[model samples]
Target: MTMDGGRALVLGGGGVAGIAWEAGLVAGLAGRGVDLAAADVFVGTSAGSVVGAFLAHGGDLEQAIEIMSARPDGDPAARPPKPDMDLVMTAFALMYDTTLEPREARARIGRMARETPTDGRGAALEEIGRRLPSPKWPDRHLLVTGVDADDGSFVVWDRDGDASLEAAVRASCSVPCVFPTVEIGGRHYMDGGVHSMTNADLVEGASTVVVLEPLAHFTPRDRLERELKTLGDARTVVVGPDQAAIDAFGVDVLSMRLWGPGFRAGLAQAPAVAAQVQEVWAGA
Candidate 1:
């Protein structure tokens, strides 16, 4: 379970705001220009998978933050639920918008989700997935988790690459019925967080496990820790939004506000998170 002296960082799941909160942590790392040790396996579920893929490819912390931190200029409520403007979004815009404002991004993702398969492959999906992580590289031990919608089982990675890899990621990021289910190898899939927020079972061969979580403060923090304790033989650390921050988000059932402009307050905490990461690394 432990990588002995090695360390692994797992970006935890968040729907809309979770990815933004993770972006703040990444922004902090970018500001410092620091790097974690080698042989670290990065595991992410849902929004975490979207961000973790970049870090796995040795993505720039600051640049990644800029993209993940996308937000509308004013009231999210003011934004169009169904815009009268052009539905067609450029690749760059679609890339970030999907997670930033998932409602809108869903339209963009919807275009590729049901793409026509050519000889058992969805060409459009392949093209979109390939462009996700900037400056792509090989031999990166990356795992993007998803769920098979038919069976409600996890569709995490194994020998992933190209459009198929992107398909897996899109499936993991897909919101059930919000965005259409994505097909890979003839099977449809949905978000992996439907099972567990952390999905720490993907963590292996690391002595230290660092998780970035954006769950509400009212969530069972201690019980989650206990569950991680049983997952593997490693030191686990979970960092997430505090009670005050969660209260500020004012989460409510079936509300778009939580994942919208209200999430900006969540981004405000990035700097402090960087400090905490630094301190944790120092102790390690």
Candidate 2:
């Protein structure tokens, strides 16, 4: 691994957890004698918690909060720097639970369609205007993106009924999208339900890297290992849900469970990771 000033890529940066990770990563690079640039896909609620976390993590929290509360820009990317990392975060913002009962996923989609496009994305606003009720009972769905349009560049979408919305948002976003995948004991796996991007596209200078994180919904440890073997000596870092899990991956795993303090420790160790990057290139 060659270390110069390569950009630090952050995937799944939509909520407080994402912001915290970005901040920690930034701080880590600084500690490692590296100048770090960062980005993410915000795809969740516009609640104060997300903004507050960004502020606490050294971002322009106030501005980010304002943009989210008011859909002032036709394109979210046009907004000024708030929570400005060295690089730009892209795609969706945060995830929210649209329905109380996830089993009734169809009903939740109906509600999303009924709501107005308070945020200014043309396609999303138009879709909501033409929505119809689902022929199902109390619907439940997972919200991978939020309705809040705080970021000027991103076109936020709700992953209510369609799990594929995750991929759609990734394809549309301005910044490279990072979709997490797991590897265990030299094998890699991607379940149909898990959101992932192709390495072929990314390797061609797409500016995206997928970092596998812990999921409450599913597990595929054996598959994860197979996937890593395919990388064949690519510089990869395994950020553990905790320090112990790091050992299981046989890679450097930064414990993510220690939200505030753990992040601080990780930030202090960034240079070690950045030093390993072989190239320093900019993304479009």
Candidate 3:
């Protein structure tokens, strides 16, 4: 791939495992003198948004790797208390009362919802956000993607936008039912992966783009293919885990077992493509 000038880096949504993979790939590229964080623009979806936020605000690869690989679930102090099942059941019962006044039911349900504790997702995102940029920290051209739940429209958050970097990243990382939907400007939003896995399409005007895709290696999707095709039409290179890496880390997104393999795979894969990446960057 040959480029004219500007470079964009796109990070796709995987999960916990995806995070490890992306971290590895970025670090690997950096080792080979291809610093993805130095790109003119950055586009992140789900897990990508987590890593992207860090890189966008002058964070380093080692920091990203350390934070992303940490086992947050294992720490009791870090984990949020579980929701009261009794309160959840009461809310469910309230839903079945056909004759109950709408106002009363709504009030009751809202109260129960308030009483119910968050499952630590908010806290986790907060902790991760702490390591990344705050609102408009450096004015980088960072774009975070999310999907509006109300109408299924794709959302992109830029640094100059009103939404804080944390809010946008939270919205972008919020998986449908697993994590709470984030509300920004009165609209509910969820994971950007619902619309595009890596969001390579966002790199439209960049002369060259590098896509770090964690899911496309095993879980193929037509949407992803179309996005890649669009990037290919311009000048783009896609990197994903090879078969050995896949074998080392299974397809379980939530499993922490893949972190090491993913990281190593990234380092290993970088050398092979370093020259090609340089050529693409140089438009040789």
Candidate 4:
């Protein structure tokens, strides 16, 4: 498959695992001399924004891989305290009513959120933003995902708004209990994954959709393969984690499980994804 062509890259948001796999996939394509910037369209959700935004800024594949694989999670002592069941339950309660349990949850989490250092997502976006001509993509070259705080609706940010690089990434990666919602202008925003997962039709005019999923490679996931078949008129490619890498990181919660697992396994998963993409681009 030709790496450089009229191709549309679809990025999924699965936290660090997604970032790691997609970063490696980009590196693999670059290793074969592909210019990611030349690709016609790019779409990213949640953590996928980390890499997609980087490309929109004219950075190379290695740059994306480095940023995604970087150990930005930091030392445990220096980072924010882990969220407990109380924090999660409180956040859930607050999602519905802001004046009751939700308000209490917000108050509790707000203090912790302010205290805990950023989850490294802001730093990654800022690094790429430095290379960008502007925060908004000149056109729709880089489309990021976000959810409306008021109605819980899905919104795709095409690097068009006045939101800063860090702000956009934070909105996309704002996992409920893990990272607190960010305020942009005056609106409260959280992670986009809540609404955009497997919703590829959200992107219009995509000639082909390339989904990079970082999860178990089992029959249950095969459903995703079938679901994508009808996503759009565009050709579709679904790449799952190498079956061997499933248990590598172990099933766990949001923090280390998201970012840490892919640091090593992602490097290995990249080449395999490279091979899979050959068919994806064969008709691109």
Question: What C-alpha lDDT, on a 0 to 100 scale, does residue 201 get in candidate 1?
Answer: 52
Q: Lowest-lDDT window of 10 residues in candidate 1? A: 83-92
- Models 1 onward score TM values of 0.66, 0.32, 0.76, 0.70
lDDT of candidate 2 over 166-270, digit per residue (tens): 233322221211212112223211111212211111222223333423221123344345544554444444342334322222221111222454244345445
Which regions in candidate 4 have their CA more than 4 angstroms from the true location? 1-6, 33-37, 60-78, 85-140, 216-231, 256-261
For residues 51-113, could you state the per-residue lDDT of candidate 3 as single tens digits?
787777877756566655675667632443444445544654553466876345544554444
Q: What residue runs in model 1 are displaced by over 4 Å at the alpha carbon? A: 1-5, 30-39, 61-131, 134-138, 158-163, 216-219, 231-233, 243-267, 270-276, 282-284
Q: In order, what lDDT does every prediction score?
A: 0.54, 0.29, 0.69, 0.57
Candidates sorted on TM-score, descending = 3, 4, 1, 2
Candidate 3 colliding pairs: none
Task: Report each candidate's C-alpha RMSD, comma-separated, in the order given.
Answer: 9.9, 16.7, 8.2, 6.7
Best candidate, TM-score-wise? 3
The digit string of per-residue lDDT tens for model 1 on 1-284 reads 33344566776666556665565556555556434423267777777776677677665544544443343435332231331112222322443442455334433344444442223222322332454664343356667777665654555773444435566766776554334567777777766665556766556555666777766363446535655765466666667775545665554311333443324444566555666666655455
Query: Distance (Å) between predicted and true CA of 5, model 2?
Result: 17
lDDT of each residue in 1-284, candidate 4, tens digit only: 12233566767776656666666666666676544445576667776777677666665545544543454557342234555556555544443453655335444444444454455434433443343335555454676777655445566665566776667777777766566667777876666655544445554455656776554342245435554555556677776667555665454324444444564566566666666666666566
Pairs in clash, predicted candidate 1: 3-206, 3-207
Please report the candidate that would top lDDT against the real structure.
3
